[model samples]
Target chain A: MPKTKAVDLVVVGAGPAGMAAAVAAAEAGVEKIILLERQAELGGILPQCIHNGFGLRYFKEELTGPEYAHRFVQELKKHPGLKVKTETMVVTITPDRKVVTTSATEGLVCYQAGAVILAMGCRERPRGAINIPGTRPAGIYTAGSLQYLMNIEGFLPGRSAVILGSGDIGLIMARRLTLEGVRVKAVLELMPYSNGLNRNIVQCLEDFQIPLYLSHTVTEIFGEKRVEKVRVAPVDKDFKPIAEKGFDLSCDTLVLSVGLIPENELSLQIGVELDPATGGPVVDSFYQTTVEGIFACGNVALVHDLVDDVSTESALAGRAAAAYLKGEIKTKRWLPVKAGRNIRSIVPQRIVVGQTTPLYIRARYPERNATLHVGDGQTKQQVVSPGETIYYTLKPEDIRTADGWVEVSLEGGRVHD
Target chain B: MTELTCIVCPVGCRLKVEQGKEGLKIIGNGCRRGVAYARDEMTAPKRMLTAVVQVAGSERMLPVKTETAIPKAKIYAAMEEIKAITVSPPVMIGQVIKENLAESGVPLVATGTIAGEGCFKPLEKSLGSE
Candidate 1:
């Protein structure tokens, strides 16, 4: 039996989100805040991502993933009130805001907090999830796992490879493999438009002359003991393989960069309500979930395309959780924020009518030169060129004037005069 | 007059360019990069190249890339040059390709993987039979 420790706040997973949340909560004058990370180090995925192009929006400077995370870790070190536990896996979170965790050195420990911040981040969808018909091969790997193995572990996955999915990770890996003197046969993307950034497509695949098969997918993988060949085919609009168009290419390795899913097992265990569209928790304007005292942010709340956005959202959650603990936020009406056309999902699904704060929303698909109109149907306020991510600030008085259901819609690509 | 959007940032500022008596008049640029980008878009567009080269006497193709962006017009020429080259194993990172493809004078550089045993090798019998 492990003794339970009581704290003002408990934040799980010390990734960008967890770190940001913890620091924000501590800054909000919350004492006895604990940040737990399952990994041995505090930086999380950022340490394994050595490439630049991070922190541009947040820091206004180009930084490698590690460098961006290092900045946060440095800031966290100066906070005396924050306690960070590394190599600690939080096994379960109770509905009443109790966390049970197992640590290598500590064995088992339980902690109860007035408010909990769920920032477990996200996990890459594995090859198994897609169920590509193939013999279990040794050379197949998830793009993120391969990134860690090659960048951190100093091991090359394979010499000749074919990557599935033109996600940023796979595209970047294609470039990485080309530099390493490896044969990257091709980069296959199921969608007509790449899931990755256009910059990545230019730098990673097009630059390398690595053939990009759009509207295509890996239908089968062939190997007896290790990956020897892969069968790919063109996919229809619905993403199903067109059998006649299949072609087999010889390769030793296959890397899957299918998609990322928000890690919300702990949130589910705690009975937190979830949003099916984003595969994350349903959070209000303040990033608080249906569970009164528990808050969620970062990928655990919704998978953000960029880590900078994750840190920004997590900081808000952390600050809000601290404020909740201090009994600063009081309201009964949490107006629901619904997604409109071309929009995937929005964080802080509901907003307290009288709270003056900015709402951040990421679109599911990329739209060019579009206006994002926000507000109730009758009276709407429009922001021009909403792009992929659109942020708008509304005073408490503005939201109170709306009836119900704040709608976000893409008003074509016409530039507002 | 032609209007182009800058892909450099999320801001995606639309730059309107009109043919001027001197060369080109650019407007609606937000930053210095946008100005440069507009100028480049008018005259010539360049892009960075990263690709694989066949390893001599080995089935593996070494990943290689240009150190900098090359003139967009020369991209096809650069691709042709890359296809014609081959390197031996034991290649090191930052190793320069045999020929410079970019007219800009920047050499194509190797990014980093080295060949190892148990790696992919095309069936040797097929080569001789063919």
Candidate 2:
């Protein structure tokens, strides 16, 4: 007996940060809103991400993940106070914002909202979270479930492959399983620089020549039910695995792409406050989240290397959950932000001191001209990377009224010395 | 010298290219499209191809792209002419489907939209934690 209904803004996962936070909370007027989506449609994995470098800065053109989710599902069909559902599924959100969902023509439903915008977008780390030893096979997958079985079920998950983690969806499925004829060969990676995006390692593996290797990995995973081979190796710089400089590599599919995890189990069922270095949800500067009216933006709230910055951070968490459901938000006074020196993560882990926010940041290594700073404001970057994501804004004279914590850092670099 | 990187955007910009003395120079480009992407990576290097086609009766595929960049050595003959054409739906997002494709004159289109055959409902499963 679940039938509830309430609403004023629900938004959970329609992807591309829940259709840009339900079209910016129905263009910030947020009458009823709703938006769920457990995928039956509504561009979540941007329609199985058919690639083409998605929207260059919010549709400044270049689109393709289903034309950047068909321009936000056509502006969420011009909001009639928005109500999209699609295959449904939410399954409990409750911290008093309720939600519940599940569908097959509405089998269970519940809502009671008034704010909640979590946009559950992220997840793809599988292969039992990277333990990868061997045997239990069937040709591994998870370069986003083989890019959703080759771009949304036309199905074709193998025929010579090896890819492991050069990210950017294992370098765009090593050029989409080499333009669908497969035979990809090697992409490996355990870091040595290449958490993807250097123009996806120069257009998806140096434009189809494949073999990226880098610090290499894979160290064992033969066949039995259908994998055939894979031993590869070569890590040592502290990454270890140099077992006789291993090497096996026969193939029949393996994929992986190795990262992204920000689905925050419904933002940990309402306790919220999470940012264990960007596993996401710990917000401020209007993306809200430490659980007030409950808000979160793209990639659950952090893993954004761009989908045009997850449609500009889920359209500012759909206008900050429609200005916190129209109480028109005010509370203020936060300011923590940290992550200094060679920084690794920093998404609004609390901000507000004078307002202007943006922040993001994320460089744990790789620099060029560097110098980011942010507590007293600074900017320089002519190249910086933990695989890109620096963006800064912070002004209000960069925390002048400084209540204390602000950090951010990155500092010096070469610039051709 | 030679280096490269500038995949047009996402601020990749590494560039370097050399031969100076008045000809190709380039060098850590931050813009000018990385000096026309290092003068089209030393001559002729196009890209934008995107794929997925099969959609006649529908095991559904549709996606598509190109209406522009192609010759990165004709992307496997434009994915074997977009894996042997199939489109029969009301399919319209930019429509086209294949005009000069592998000939590299461009035209391939359809960045998604389909509406034919039982309209697809079966393959949804795989939602996270794969």
Candidate 3:
């Protein structure tokens, strides 16, 4: 039988989100907090992301991924009451907040925690998910996987590659490969607009003179032993491939940066309700999910574009968990928040009245001079893109007049050129 | 007139630069930093270089970056210099690796710590490979 111990709080994963949650919980005076990470060391994916342009918001200074994570890691060292467990894989989490973890050092252990915070972050969508018709061959890797191989393991995946999808990682990897003497043939995006930030498009692809083909998709991949060439074609408005306009590009590797899905297997194990739109657990303003004493934040809550927002959101979850342990949180009325016109997704699907609630929203499409209508209050934005997150705080007074529900909509804007 | 996207921050303001009678004129900038970014980008572009260097007697690689942005044209040359050098372990983060990288006048420094052997284990193979 595995040894069982009681703890005040148990944090799963040690990424930016998990690390911030643990640090914030400890700062709230929660003693005997255990942070579990499946990897050998901490910092999660930040260690492998060796690029600049992080920490511009939270720290007010531009930093690399590792540097941004190291700032919080240094804070984790200050709390002696926090127990950080590395290389610990959490196998199951029960509804009653029982956490079961396994590791080589500590074979098997069970922790009955007062509150459990889900911060497992997210995972990359691979080739199988997108159904790119291709010969099952080697030399195909996700953008993130390729990044880990080169930046961490110091191995080039291939000499030349064609990257599909202009997600930030793909764009960044295009430049990284170019700097390392790899020939990046081009970046192809099925959508008319890229899902990555504008800065990434300008610096990573345009800076390196890599051609970006909009409304283009890879129709077929041809290679027996390794990826040798791929057939790409332009897409119509309906996203169907135009076979006549197809062309071939020779490359040794195919890097996919299509999308990222939140890692919520553990969240599902405990039967936490999920939002199909966000593909993550639905939470309230306090970052607490439908299940009592369980909180979700960061990518597990919703895929955020920036790590700065992840740290801020996870810290709220941590403090809320601390409050839950002290019995300060009460179940009151939760107003259903709806996504109206032009809104792709909004976090905090439910919110309690009488508190300043922050809402994170993503537009369905890029628009110019759009006005965001949240309940009775409204704000204007010069430009809003699906690639960027829109942050709005609903004041207590603003929601007081709400008749049991709040709707978020964008109006008075045309599609951006 | 030249058009560019400001990469100074995530806001990513799009700017238009043109040579006016006075000097250079920038428009559509959301902040002051955007103006400076456009001016520098138009005149002499610079970018921060980040790469991994091999650590002697270990399979681990230490991540390093320039203290500041260097001239954009010298990136490949700077990468060559980075590839030619190797450092011993027991190195701390922020330790200077080179005083001036590719004559760009920016110091190259380690961004991660590489402790002695037996204290930290090398990471396992990445799951990206099939």
Candidate 4:
């Protein structure tokens, strides 16, 4: 026998986003809201992250990942309308707003929500996501998995390691492994520039004497049962590996930190529209997805640079969902937003007219002394990198001016415009 | 000219520290904080060491971090000292797990609380695939 319950809102994944959303909905007077997480604890990846760079924007202080998550998780306990279910796996989501989940304690449970907030976050791109000719070895792992192994499990992956992709996690791991007395041989990135923050590149790589090779990639992996050595090669502009200038290095492990893909099986089940650039569901302002009452925020909607940003975005979704349940938000036509020049993508793909909206964007390339102009509002930035998210506030004046859609374009700093 | 990028914020201004008879002069920093960061980078750098320490009553490891950053050179030594340590029940947040870790005079404090009773089991499963 299964129990089907009705809830005002069902928020998925109890990471920063889901927790924040559920709490916000509760604060907004939504009487029945449930938060679901597969992890045994409420914090999600925060427990393993253990890094101290989080919560600068939201909390106005540098906090470790666990600390940042606890702030919301503690508050979530006080919300009367919110119910948190940890160790619960949501198996399916239907178009009619039904969430089917299975848990050890609550076996075969279903919740019909007035609105569904998808905040399942993201996952690292594994070996299969990319084509690297290699042996199926035991030591291959994603940077995040390696982090969990080392940080939470108290087990180092290997004695020495070679990390592919100099993203934030890989760079942080280089320093972390060194601190743990594990020899990090090198960090290789296929792109000419690193995709991690400038501070991370300096503090994690430069401080540790770790070499970061640009435009380089692992060509082949050589090992019978465990990773023994890897062949490295330089690549051309088109990212085609060149063999002539290739090299080889022996290492016990290979860690991939290439990229993150939003976990969207449930969202797909509901047939929500996804943006190809973000690899998550597309939404208008208020973080409301194309589906009328369905909403999404955090990495499930778009990959944010900071956990603080995730909490901020998820709060809007929660508040808006509560409003939707209370019949407060008036349904209206949504105007789309576009990435004009030197801009990769903009979140909240659409915006509401006559409303103030905060737009999130990233440059397609490295830019210095750049001004991002969206409609009439312009903010000058000292520098903008693909690793960091650039936030622009569209004032009510900017929204009232004219057009149906807003165009975000980066001006100055070698944009070729 | 010793140049270092200030890691305090995302701006990451390349700061120039010129040592002269008049003492140290920092240039190219975006703000006053950047100037301070250059001074520390040029001098002794410090880092807050964060790791997990086993709790006697709980199955999950309690997350511990230095109350303040320790000298950068002392991090590895600190990790070695932390590995052998464990604490018993009712571990409060900010409770010092190890005092003067690595002899740096900085205590390793707990970041997560482990309840005295009704303990939660640690996650033993391997990292899940996406």
Q: What is the interface RMSD of each candidate, in Å?
A: 16.6, 10.1, 7.4, 6.7
The TM-score of candidate 3 is 0.97
The residue-by-residue lDDT of candidate 2 on A1-417, one tens digit each, is: 697978788888787888887887788688788887876777778888887767877877677888778777777777666777777788788788888998887689888988888887788888887787878779888888778888877888778999888878888888888888889998988888887778888788777778787888897889888999889998898988888979898998888888998888878878887888888888888888876888888888888888888888789878877877778787888878778788888887888776788878888878788788888889888778787788898887777454488877877875232
Q: Write the per-residue lDDT of candidate 3 for residues A147-222, one digit (tens) a residue.
A: 9888877899888899999988989999999989999999999999998999999889988899999999999999
In model 2, the number of clashes is 0
Residues B29-110 of candidate 1 have per-residue lDDT tens digits of 7787778878887787765555566666555455555666678777667767877776766665567875467466779766
Considering chain A alone, report the TM-score of candidate 1 relative to the true chain A: 0.93
Worst 10-residue lDDT window, candidate 4 chain B: B121-130
Clashes (backbone N, CA, C under 3 Å), per candidate, total 10, 0, 0, 0
Model 4: runs farther than 4 Å from truth? A415-417, B9-14, B18-32, B56-59, B116-130
* Model 2 pairs whose backbones collide: none
lDDT of prediction 3:
0.89
By DockQ: ranked, best first: 3, 4, 2, 1
- CA lDDT of each candidate? 0.76, 0.81, 0.89, 0.84
By lDDT rank, best first, the candidates go: 3, 4, 2, 1
Which candidate number has the best DockQ?
3
- The CAPRI-style docking tier of model 3 reads acceptable
Chain A: TM-score in each model: 0.93, 0.38, 0.99, 0.97
Off by over 4 Å in 3: B119-130
The DockQ figures for the candidates are: 0.04, 0.23, 0.37, 0.34
